[model samples]
Structures are given as structure tokens and as C-alpha cells.
Target: MKKLLTLSLSFVLASTLFIGTANFAHAAKAPAQPAVSAVAKTVKQSKSYSMILSALAQNDVIGQFDPTEITANEVGALINKVTQENPQVLYYKSANVWSNGKIEFAYSLPADVMKKNRVALDAKVKKVVASINKPGLSELDKVKAVHDYLVLNTEYDYANLQKNTIPADSYTAHGALLGGVAVCDGYTKAAQLLLNKLGIENHYVIGQIGDGLHSWNQVKLNDNYYFMDVTWNDPVPNRPGIIAYDYFLVTSNQLRKDHSWIEKNWAVATDKRYSYLQTGKTAAK
Candidate 1:
């Protein structure tokens, strides 16, 4: 985790590949995070990852930025990183073109589709944030509040996705937060946004399950960091109001049973203080 701290944005910039939790459906564990002084500074400086993310948060293509601070390639990386880190960044799907120092991102939803859905999406996020923003909520309490809301609200959207019909931008936060029906990508991205909003540090985890790509979130709660795969907890074909702590908070050793990601890509999950079952407050199912 110290290695992660050395990097700008607290290793916030990484390829966090997210796939539907179909293949690795029955998986779970979680951990906590270190302090946020370093990350807070990075966010304050308008660092590369957060900078490009802020640009796309407006729900538009990339326009301008300080060249010296962010490169075209990094812009592409930021698109994915931001999508995983901030759920509000449900606008563009992926980086379309990054040439001549001018980066243009592709939209997950077409202009017309975005126009119709943007208002509703914004309203939903606002409402959720308000509910999660109550005073006296501890960082962990806030994290749980956001996590429960996501698993309760979102279901793995297999039908539209398998049909290749884009009812909403399932590839981004809009799909997860607004539609309440997203696969792993949607669940992971939604948690990323909510956790960050609650002031908890987090980053995306991209890895492979079998032959397919998959993604989930690694959150930093106070001085201890852990992992949370909201997608894995919310069962597929989801029964409403059934939230599982199976994957609520576990260490990397616990997660290795079913998940794999490039170790060099992000911070290692070593903290076990917040692991759901380990804590004794939540019994293992």
C-alpha cells in the first residue's frame, strides 16, 4: 500500500476491468485503508486522474487540460479509472481517440439517449448522496450505507446486455445508479462513486476470471484498506432487499479464492480489521 501512496492520485490511475459477476458469482471478503492525507493533496492539486475525471463529469467529451500534467495516453487511462472511481462519470464509455494532444471520448449512450436520461440520473444521484450524507455517520457507517444501497438497488442486467441492446449506459455509472440494473461493472462503478463521496479512498480492480475480464472495487476505510465486490453480494436475478455480506470486506488472501488481478496494478489488500466475518459483528453465511 505504501507503493500506492507514492504515486500521484494514490494509485488512482489503473486499469480496473469490470465484468458481470456471472462466472465468479459465488465469491466474497473485504479490508480497510490507510490515512488520506496523501490522496487529499492529490485531489486538491487537480492531479491527472481526477482532472480528466472532473472534465468528463460534465457528461461531455474531453475538451481541454494542462498538457504537462496529463498525456493523451493517460487521458485514455483516466477514462477507465474515473469510470471506476467516480460513479457520476457515467457519460462516456471509453476513450475513443487520443491524438494530437486532443482526446475525444466515446459516449456509452448516444447524444439523444443521454439527453433523455441525464436529468433522471442526476436526480437519483443527488437523492442517494443526500441519504448517505447524514451528520455523525462514521466513515465505515457511510460505507455500509452506500454498499447496502447499491446491492439493494442494482441487479446484474443480463437481458439487455446479452441482447446488445443499450437501454441505459450500462458501461458507466448512469447504468448502475439510475437504472438500478447493472452487471459487475455497474455494481463496481456505483460503489466506487458512493465510497468516494463518503470520503473513503478507493480504486478499481481489473482481473480475469476464467477466460473473461472482470472488475470490482478496493476501498480504503480510515487507516485500513479492504475490498468490496457489491456485485458479488447482490445475487443474480436479484431478489429484492436481499443483501449479502459474503463479499462485504475481506483481505486479498480471502479474495484469492475466486478473483485474480495483476498485483503490480494497484495497492495490495493487507488490512484485515474490517473483514466482514473476521470482525465478528457479522456472522459468515
Candidate 2:
């Protein structure tokens, strides 16, 4: 993975290969398994989640990859994996229509709109990165920079959730980068994308947070790994101009107080060097 980290956590309820009319919410309401667990077998076709994401990244609905031994449940897990990995690719609606193990991945946006939005999305990410990014900033500073930009620029789309009109784009990095409105998935993916631009290593950590499945990031700092949930740090109900560090840069032990995930799959995050609270970077709550 070239030391490039890509991870995002979302509620496990969204594991199915959701197909629906036009709204992200509609597709999300379908049946799903817990995050990181086996993907529900929605399609009998063979495909790798990683390969499907690569094709989608190029805006090609049709894509090919070696038919791996990975099972359908694994492919299903890619629903969240692909979403987190390619935070910027928003046109992915579903994966159906396979011939000879070649997938015709269905996209939410039309060909023209996909191209147009992709261009716009690319431009927006560059502009945003250029504006907040500065020379000679440390890794911690870079993390904070990205965190601040997202919290300041974007607002949680409570209205969309209430109206049930949430666009599919809102479920992606573009949602936070362009629309300035997203739920936890958009927020977490946007953070990872910006971190990748700064050459940071991280992973999407999926698990149960309280009563629902929520997504967050496992970020690296000073050659040590730590957990950060930007979505949790950013308060909702349109606080307008406040960013909380309560959930910023925490240890696995600290994180386990509320959030939960499979521990065996990831490195044991025992380092507290960058923990905002433990390091006295921020006042303890």
C-alpha cells in the first residue's frame, strides 16, 4: 500500500449492495451486516472490492480484475471499504450486471454529470488543500489544518436526513469537500483524502459506536498510530463555528470507552504520543 493509509468507519447497517431510486438514504435503508464482517451476498458475480473501486475511480462503470478467491461476503464488505478508500468517487450507486467476471458497476450519476462533478470535485479538493495547507507545517499541524477546514467549511446535513432527500454524492468525500454537508461517512472520508494529500498514513476503522455503526479514521503521527474521529469532534445541529477536540487523536484504550471494533485486524494502537488529552495538547474534558 506504499505506506499510504486509507480507512473510514460507518455504521454496519449499510453493508448490503444497496439499490434504490435516487437518494442515498433510500439505498442505505436496506439490510446489511455488521461492518468488517462478511458482506451479504447480493450478487453471485465474482469481483474484488479493490478492483471495482479502481474502475470507479477512473469513471469507468465497466472494469476488470483477476477473479480472486474472495467470497461474496467479502465483496459485500467493500460497500464501506470502497466508499472509504475512494472518498472522492461519488458516482458508485451499485454493482450489477456481470459477464465473464467483468463487472458493469452501476453509477448514480449520468455519464455527463459524473464527468462534470468529477472535474468540479477535483478542482474543489485542490483549491481547499491549497488554501489551508502551508509550507513547513508538522504532521500534527497538518492533521489539525485538515480537521479545521472540514469543521469550519462543512455543516452536517441534518435537513437532508430529515427530508430523506440526501443525494448519493453526500455519502462521499465530495459531500464534505464540495457540498459542505455530509453525515459521518462524508466527514471521515474527506479527512482521509486530505491526509493522503499531505502524505499521511491512516486507515478507516469501522466499529459500533454507542447504538449505531459509525465510521472514523486511524491516523499515524510521529511513526505511531492513533484513532481520530473528526465527525465525533465536529458537533452537529450547526454549531456554525466550533470544533471539539474531545475525540481528536486518541489512543485505542481511550477510544474503547465508547467505540468498539475488531482488534485482531489492526495493529495494537498503544502509543499516546499524539493524544491531544494525554499529551496535554488540549485540556482534558
Task: Please tell me which predicted candidate would have the highest TM-score against the true structure.
Answer: 2
On residues 120-236, what C-alpha lDDT tens digit does candidate 2 reach at each position? 888987887787678888888988888878877778666776666666676668878888987777788788888887788877666665445566788888878788877766555
Candidates' C-alpha lDDT? 0.59, 0.63
| Residue 49 lDDT, candidate 1, scale 0-100 | 61
lDDT: which candidate is best?
A: 2
Q: List the residue pairs that clash in candidate 2.
A: 7-203, 7-204, 8-204, 9-215, 10-215, 11-213, 39-73
- Worst lDDT 10-window in candidate 2: 18-27
User: Tens digit of lDDT per residue, candidate 1, span 217-264?
Assistant: 787876776778777776656677766676777788877776777665
Q: After TM-score superposition, what is the CA distance of residue 21 in candidate 1 from its true location, in Å?
A: 11
Cα-based lDDT at residue 61, candidate 2: 66
Please give the distance, in angstroms, between residue 47's alpha carbon in candidate 1 and its true position after superposition. 6.9
